[model samples]
Target: MKRLAISLSALALCAAASAQVTITEPWVRGTVPQQKASGLFMRIDAEQHVRLLGGSSPVAGVVEVHEMAMQGEVMKMRALSHGLEIAKGHSLVLKPGGYHVMLMELKQQLKAGDRVSVTLTFEDVASKQRFTREVQAPVTALGGAQPAPAAHHRH
Candidate 1:
């Protein structure tokens, strides 16, 4: 039937959309007992041009994509309201002191060695199709993946 064919076609499209993006090295920064916020880091690879719309996690009341930059003599952090773009075949690295996921209003403390679930949403640049990928990010110590001193310091 025509309806069955159409349904199968739509299912194929959905599968393709979800397969175009891949995530690796996903992690969330460990937070102190009373800390209300933390950061999540990961590497995203795109097989097609897409935009990272943002993400959500049950552990945090609010989740957003943020960028940290040096504005003159002071460092500034701001959310990327328009989302981030990734070219086809390229990758985006979400790391500390750069682009990362801000997890605010935590429901509980995220300690090292724990895992959290984060669902990232993305939109295909050409077709405007949207999809989501759920990733399990391990909680690493605050000093886990810093720049030079990252490996040396651990609590």
Candidate 2:
């Protein structure tokens, strides 16, 4: 009876740990066939404060977390090495013309209506723990012209 109780407790703890992070509305915007780069968007919610370590996808050879920022009249996209943070009770948004996951070195052409799978990694701040979840993204047509690379500043 004691052994059974312990086993049940462990199972419950495992279930609770896995449900801490949630992702929503994962999608990829479609681009021209020859286009080399594209953006991925999603919303991440967490029960506790956590940091997004990074992401991986089979569709692209390289996946990078990026942020768009303006510096002295020049807009630029920069790679985020430490990843984005998701505070408790808050959500993080990855959207067009904003913070995004840059999918580089495409393995196959992504077309409108196609679905892609990506895995996002999250780390718990207090526990120094990590977890990952897979998200499915559907490709859709771009709303307008592709975003241009951030302009260079000569200072």
Candidate 3:
């Protein structure tokens, strides 16, 4: 009984530690059955300045942090090669036509109401502190989600 209690206490501590970086309103865009890729959006709030290193999921073979912005009249999309930084007390929102998580080589299609399990990795900018958090996001309609397309963005 003591061993069980200790194990449960340890699990609780781990849950609290993993929640240091709060993930809110997490969601993945709906994709066609044949689509191979999709986008994920969420808001991250941290107590200290931190960098979003990267993330992954069982649904996709590759996951990357990406950005979408306007280059003159054309829309440009690319990976955030060095990761994205979130300042202390500031919430970093990942949405379409902005900073978002790109899921490539998806193993299956995602529809409305579906849940996605995502693991987000983070690193403290000041102390190089590292941690990861798991998020369960529900899929929403194609145009129903917030943080839609925008023009012009600077790194």
Candidate 4:
């Protein structure tokens, strides 16, 4: 009985530690015919610090976490060599023209109202433990305006 109690306690602790990453408002930008790339935007909240490793999807052959920033008066977009970090108690907002998931080499044009399945990978900052979450993101119209950031909640 004592051993069973200990095991249950450990299991609960593991769940609390690793299952705190919440993904909300995930969406994929719709693509026009012949368009080869699109973006995935979402809000990520992590109770524990974690790194947003890149993700994969059946719709795209290549998926990368990219950032857009002004370089010498020109806007440049590039994949982050390392993943983006979400500090504990902070929310990471991914939107158009900022930090977002780049889905390239699209297999087919994504239409608005369609759904895409993407698997996002993440790593715990303290334990270096790797985990993945499956997200079903709805496709929005191409060139859709970026939405304002949602309020973040801290525990």
| Alpha-carbon runs more than 4 Å astray in model 1 | 1-3, 146-155
Task: Supply the TM-score for candidate 2.
Answer: 0.79
Which parts of model 3 have CA positions greater than 4 angstroms off? 1-19, 146-155
User: How many angstroms is residue 127 displaced in model 2 relative to the true structure, after the best TM-score fit?
Assistant: 1.2
Q: Which candidate number has the best TM-score?
A: 1
TM-score of each: 0.88, 0.79, 0.80, 0.83
Candidate 4 Cα outliers beyond 4 Å, as residue runs: 1-18, 146-155
lDDT (Cα, tens digit) per residue for candidate 4, span 1-155: 99999999877766765586998888888899999999988889988999988989999998889999999999999999799999999999898889999999999999876888998888888988777778888787677653333422121
lDDT of 3 by residue, 1-155 (tens): 99999999878755655655778777888888889998888888877788898888999888889999999999999998889998888888898889999989999998877887878788767756567888787777655664234411111
State the weakest 10-residue window (summed lDDT) of model 1: 146-155
TM-score of 4: 0.83
Error of 2 at 54 (Å): 1.3
Greater-lDDT candidate between 1 and 3: 1
C-alpha lDDT of all candidate models, in order: 0.86, 0.74, 0.80, 0.84
User: For model 1, what is the error of residue 62's alpha carbon versus the real structure, in angstroms, after optimal superposition?
Assistant: 1.5
The lDDT ranking, best first, is: 1, 4, 3, 2
Q: How far is candidate 2 from the true structure (C-alpha RMSD, Å)?
A: 8.5
lDDT of 3: 0.80
- Give candidate 2 regions above 4 Å deviation: 1-15, 143-155
